[model samples]
Target: MASSNSLLSEMQFLCPICLDVFTRPVSTPCGHNFCMSCITCYWNDTPVCQCPICKETFEKRPDLKVNTFISELASQFMSLQVTDAHIWSADQQKASCGGAVLCDICTNTKQEAVKSCLECQTSYCDVHLEPHHRATGLKRHTLVDPLASLENMICKEHTRLLMLFCKNDQVLLCDVCAISRHVNHDVISMQQAYKEMKALLGDTEAKVQQMIQERLQKVQAMNESVKQSVTETKDVIANGVQDLTTLVSEIQKSQKELVKVMEEKQKEAEEQADEFISGMKQEITELQKTMMKLRELKQTEDQLCFLQSFPNSSLLPHTMDLSTFSFNRHAEIQHIRKSLSKSVSELKMLLNKMNTEIQKFSDDTDVSNNTMLRYMQQFEVDIVLDPDTAHPLLTLSDDGKQVKYSMGSGLWGIQNLNPNMFTEHLAVLGQRGFSSCRFYFEVFVGGKTEWCLGVATASVQRRGALVRGPGCGLWAIWFLEDKFETFSSPNVPVHFGKPERIGVFVDYNGGQIYFYDRQTATLIYCFTECFFTEELYPYFNPCDNEYGSNLDPLIIVPVSRME
Candidate 1:
């Protein structure tokens, strides 16, 4: 019995089709477990012998190696069950008086009826069950052992069945589990567990690879970007270094030029200083000579006093002897006085001559031109943005001092031009040369129309007056009325000389010009039509409180008025 149990445990006893104890052992082409009755029933009574698990058909039946071990184990299990049933109360009721439990098939009919067979594990009435259990050759028909049915089953956990599996941690454990134990434990659906796990593992693997690949690409791109940035930075720094070096060189050159000029100025000053000192020294020498002359005069006067003091009383009392001495001495004193006067006069003339020569040498250089170096091109006129032949030029702000410029050509304004004033004011052009107002919007007025426009004195008075020269009045751009009754100021203000598209873009005070968009303002366009332009050469700025040249705009763009 032990050998039979051991062999049955090694042999696979259950039929594949029934998943139960084999009904009739049979062999397939693969020599695996099968039951003749089970396979034949599923084969639809066909002659084909096929492997049930894979459906691989065989042309001929393989030799049936009836597993003696499985047969013996089955017989032993059945016999043990039957023998145990003889002691049962239900089986004892149907036993013979000799203690033999007889099948009703071999026993006599009793008044009491018995139905179920304990040993056969079947139910029947006393009339059939007794006979069924008592059938001579088939009394030992197989009965299942319930307790042994599940004894050999093992769980996926490699433990006993009826156990729990933790999901998060992928671990199987016994039934004494707490929430803490399963907090990170792997649990699963017990019935469809393997199929679910296969799908889950495949999905996880694919997702992990995808994420890793995405991150890898990102890292690579970042590294490349960093490298490019580093290269660009290096280039920028190199450019900066070059610019710095150039600036330093330029500064050094300027410094050298400055030093050279300064030294030349210092030399001139030194020469002047030396000339001044020499003159002073010469004056000092003359003073010393004059002092010597004065001392001599004092000595001669003392001598004369001494001679007079030994007077006429002691000598001959105003008489003949005294007359001789007085005559001789008087003539000598007169000669000495004449000599001293001549010497003093000569010294004065010498001092005066030296002072005159020194002054002539000192006043040699002209300081005006060199000091005002920046104002070198005092007469150069810059033709900023030309007269607008395109759209209307609108001046945003003009105080006749400074102008704000904007070109509202699109939804927004852009391309700003900045404030630039002429060294000589240009608000009124032709301050030096003549300027022509040819036509305003291409409306031609016949003949030599001379529009002498000038800014005359306004009540407020313009601040930075530019055209303040003789023959010019207040700040204005007026067109000369060729006809006696010509109301050109109000009628045809602008003349571009011919019938052409021209726009006025300026505020007199703000000094701005808008030569681009037409939709911004009609006032500016009206002013343009009012512009009285005349052709003249060498225009002069009159000495009146007239127009000043102040302008504003950072960048300027021109547009066609017609377009």
Candidate 2:
């Protein structure tokens, strides 16, 4: 049985046309056997009937019959091949299970290849791979995993394994190519190049992660800003609604009072007309009674009786003087209407004038406070107060940007007084003076009850009892008793809300000084048509301490540029 199995393994059981174990063996008249379907298809495609092995032609197509003996032999050979494959390693059995590389040596049955020999450029199943492990010459052959294509792993030019990389050419190289053509082309081992590429990839990944985190933080910040903006918008809408509702209510109340006054005037005119009518009717009744008595006297035919009963010819019955009495109901009502109409016309004119100013203010409100302030900040100057020009009762900050009233009056030691010192006024001037061009600065006035701010001419008097006004060469505004006043010729009152910060802008060529509420961006006051003949300096006054009521320092805040 063993010798028979060996002979069967050596026997060629594969059909020449299909190159596989025959499904049904057939014998032609020429005595050659092939797969039944394969020979039939081959004969149908040819012009003449012939034997594939002997090249013998036949006049007529020969009838074919299945060779049962040969079919049985092919089936036995297939069974034997599978039994031999099962004896191989378990890994080879699994590899040959499905979709595995077929061994080139197996003739009757398909067997999965376990390894590929690079030297022979051929794949071997475990059954055929035994020679490589046992034979001395075959053991030196390089083997790798089963590969379908080996051309890609070899350098096409040198026909050798690609073991090196040419950095300059960005291509694979073999040892022979590296020494002959790529010697000076930055050649490096494939392993070395892989390490460098992996390190670079790791660094790139880190940078990408950092960029992602930064973007996420920016998105979070932007979302928060949007939320804050939404909150502020809602607050503004609520305040506007409340203020408008109050104004409308007051207007309605005034209209009701106007209606009540007109109604009262109408009621008075009606009452006076009723009194006049009553008097006239009483007079008519008395006249009618006198007429009836005269008729009775006439019927008696007694002239004496009639003449005695009649009212005296010289003395008529007492009655109202109708000729002199005149009640013009319409005239009184008309006079009231005319008076009200004149007043209403004047009121409308005043209301329209007020509306014009309100519209202007509303237009200015369209620009946000930050926007307007940022615009003005472009012209901001670095102002430092001059110690020589500061008042004795005022304490200056080390940075020369703040000042406040000294709490202890006698704490200041007597020192050499300069001509620029303020002897009476608790004021200070900036160190830098502007003779031309425009300048702007901001001051924090919060927590202070009284303070003064403006620009003054350098030639102004710094002596005792300094007169504060333009006529005295000093232009300034001061807050006292909760009232804002500009120190002009006669001291004009300014109507404005309490401001926490004040921004002062001066147009030297235009000769104007403008004050603005920094928080609201609302215009506080403006001094126009001024003639400046000398250099101007920033002015500040903390006023009196008033037992700590006005002790908060006036800070010259730093300004930053905004885009």
Which ranges in model 1 have alpha carbons more than 4 Å from their true place?
1-191, 298-563
CA shift of 559, model 1, Å: 35
- Weakest ten-residue segment in model 1 by summed lDDT: 437-446
**For model 1, how does the per-residue alpha-carbon lDDT over 1-563 read when each residue is reduced to its tens digit?**
23567547435667777876665566666667666667667676666767768778777755565656666766665566556565574665744333322333434553222433334433334555444557775565432212111222223233234245566656554443424356555555454456777899999999999989978977986898699979988997799689768967976886697578657866776676676677667766776776675565557657766565443443212222323322243464577569757866996797688567446435533322221111222322322322211112223222211112223343223223323222223222222222332211111111223322222222212234434332333323333322111122344444333211213323332222222112321221122212223322221111111223212221212332321
Candidate 1 residue 350 C-alpha distance from true site, Å: 61
Give the candidate number with the greatest lDDT.
Answer: 2
Best by TM-score: 2
- lDDT string, candidate 2, 1-563, tens digits: 23676756545687878888887899888778889999999999899999898989989888788899988888888887777666665567666563577787889896999998877777899999999999999998888888666666776776677779998998888889999998778999989989987998999999999989878866886798699979988997799789778877977887898789878877887787889888778888988886776666668767876667666573346887778877676787788779878877996897798677456546645455446566667789999988898887777777778888884343333223678898888888999999778889999999688888898888888888877554787787887646678876435678546788889888887778888887777777888758888999999988986534787889999754433
In candidate 2, which residue pairs get closer than 3 Å at backbone N, Cα or C atoms, i.e. clash?
Answer: none
